[model samples]
Target: MDKSHQTKAFRRERVRVGVVGVGGFGRSHLGAVESLASAGRAHLVAVADPFREQHVELDSRLSAQGVAWHSTLEEMLEKETLDAITIATPVPLHFGMTRRAVEKGVFVYLEKPPVPLLSQLDEMIAWDEDFRVAVGFQLIYSEPIRFLKQAILDGKLGTVRSIRGGAAAPRRQSYYNRASWAGRMSINGEPVFDGPMTNALAHVLQNILFLGGGDAWSFARPTSLRGELYRCYPVESFDTSCVRGVLDTGVEFAFAGSHAVRDESPHTLEVVGTRGTLRLTGGTFSSDIPGLELPQHAGSDVPMLASVSRFMDYVCGQPETDIIRLEDTRGFVETTNGTLVSSRGIFPLDARFVESYQVEGDPGLDVLGLGDLITQTITTGRLFSENSAPWANRTPTVTREEIQSAVLEEWIFGAEENPKNATACL
Candidate 1:
């Protein structure tokens, strides 16, 4: 084929794409698809959201581009013949939406923490026989993370020893009030398990497991986990957590996170090896390795955009890249589930240890000395209980098998009543 023919063939390989959900993080997905569409790499065929009419400007703008809007994913799928669809719905709706797309033989770019429960994730994995679904752990697509993973694999970090990561970002009362399911263990009989370790700061936890894996493209499965779950805010689920565990490869890992802190700290990870240590904060990395550097992307540095582009390339018949798949997230699901079981249940922190403050006209809580506690945990690879937090509970360790067989209702409303139904106290 001549050069002109090759160029024509490339232009004809655009993937037809649709997006589900358009609020909050869903807007980011819409923007990514639009950007790809502008580059002639994809066609933004349609979007579906229950509240599609709420965003008047967005609806008009997308409609002007010949994009269709629907009140449900079923309608969108029935009318549009899409090569791929991005599912950005709520935690509970992910499985049903993905199952619909899968039934139609459409590829999917599922949002992070794909499903709240391991069993639901397992069902998705079973349905995805053709390996067409890509879980959106955007950081795994970043150049810095990719470089760091490769460095660990190439022995640049020496023998991997331990991994620790944490983030302290305060969430106002309005944050949890924005949705019915926010900060809840379960909503209407479906597992949401919304919390720092599973929802907001989950990327850091997932990345820790990803780097701890034996190979470049796998996540280390957790064999056992010990954790403490606490809530300073009036939410059914925890706003703060500290979990430590051993991976299948025997590497020890620790993570701490909170939505009850006074100030925000950048999400950071530390990988300590025999010869040197590596640190990643946000998009940048600093290490003890001589002259080590991160690669640059030709397009945007945003991880979400990079992830969307990679998935679109795969849909367009490019060779399969090492993008995250459904099977790769088993370790993450196991760790999340295990943390809940290990803690027995989310403990409400003593009111005396929590102080209320207003941030930007929104009511918020600051757990006394929580910033230092998080720092201590991440630095020493210790749980809050080990660090001697006065209010911290020493919970027993739980195995992955126990987590898999555990019942959700037992965790939420076992012998103890739902903490949210009572006063906030230890």
Candidate 2:
């Protein structure tokens, strides 16, 4: 992940990529990939999704090239020799699918939250310094987020004192009601935590790390976590929750999220500091606000566009940017794991303060733009403690595996199952 390494090109002739799970994000990813392929930048070969209906749309849209469709994801993986797969499955399936993809040595453009559990993250990422693998953290692809990062760096906001974020949106029970896996924590077990944190506003923690200097392991810590399941959703108690914490750097941040808000427009971010403040009232998708510019790309995506023009460039390899490294992912995942800790009660004070950081000047003048690559810059080295937490009066330690293995409360995948006390890991 050095400048000299960035100088090396992971170029190819044509990126013969495949698409998996063409439901929501998959279709969008396919659009971008297809556009790249049609311009001869990348090749869109095939797609896989459980829903058969997904096939008709892509088949109609992608032309006769190599657009094979499959009802099951495994079948697609087994049948096709693909360079990569754009995975947009539900949150629960993210880990399993991404692991399988990397296991097959297929580079993966996996949709975000990386995986629900940190342990699941360890299972998927390839550690070899030789092969090429990528995680699809599309939030980084948004163009305007880049602008915010740069603006902060350029001192547009002067000194970033604290950041407060909110994502309040109502998801009809229908949305969670339609799919068996919608609000559940495990594809097999009950729902854990709430619907929003893992489901809707997952990026809250993500963008926080990006803004507060990425890599939560070294730079992040939870001072206090107070949130409610909101007593609304049937699946789990918390459909909404908020927490306040200090980055290891002591930068205070407040995060509030809810899947029950029911608003025509949802999502907003405002960072206050010494000079001025910036706010993204409606996220990248646009809202009633009207004038807010948006980002087209985000931190995690900058590298993909930088040197990658075709599938071959990917196959031959391009850069060794560990922008999406397992460790970097662990930074966020460990923090996610800490969320479970908060639920259990006593949150810990990490070993040291997070190193203070600032973005590199202009994230982009445009409010809506692909965020700067500064997010990746934060992980240029180890950002958090990888060893057990031996620095506390009560040095209790938690790993990603613990979270993945913990028994989730009993619940249904898409529906509720009657039960008093149940423990299962979906």
Give the candidate number with the greatest lDDT: 1
Give per-residue lDDT, candidate 1, residue 92. Answer: 76
Clashing pairs in 1: none
lDDT of 2: 0.50
Worst 10 residues of 2 by lDDT: 364-373
State residue 338's C-alpha deviation in candidate 1, in Å. Answer: 0.2
Off by over 4 Å in 2: 1-10, 60-63, 125-133, 189-194, 214-228, 283-316, 320-323, 345-426
**Scored by CA lDDT, what does every candidate get?**
0.83, 0.50
Give one digit per residue, the lDDT tens place, for model 2 in 1-426.
Answer: 332322333456677687887777666776677667777767677788767664675567655564787777688889887877777777667666766776676777666667765545655543423334455544543455556666656666667777666555555445556776665544565223335655577666566656666332122444433222222334433444444455655566666555433342345566666765676655442222234344543333542443233323445455534344444455466555555544442122221311111124211111010011111111111111111212212213333345455433322232244221111100
Worst 10 residues of 1 by lDDT: 1-10
- Residue-level error in angstroms, candidate 2, position 356: 45
Top TM-score model: 1
Off by over 4 Å in 1: 1-12, 289-300, 412-417, 421-426
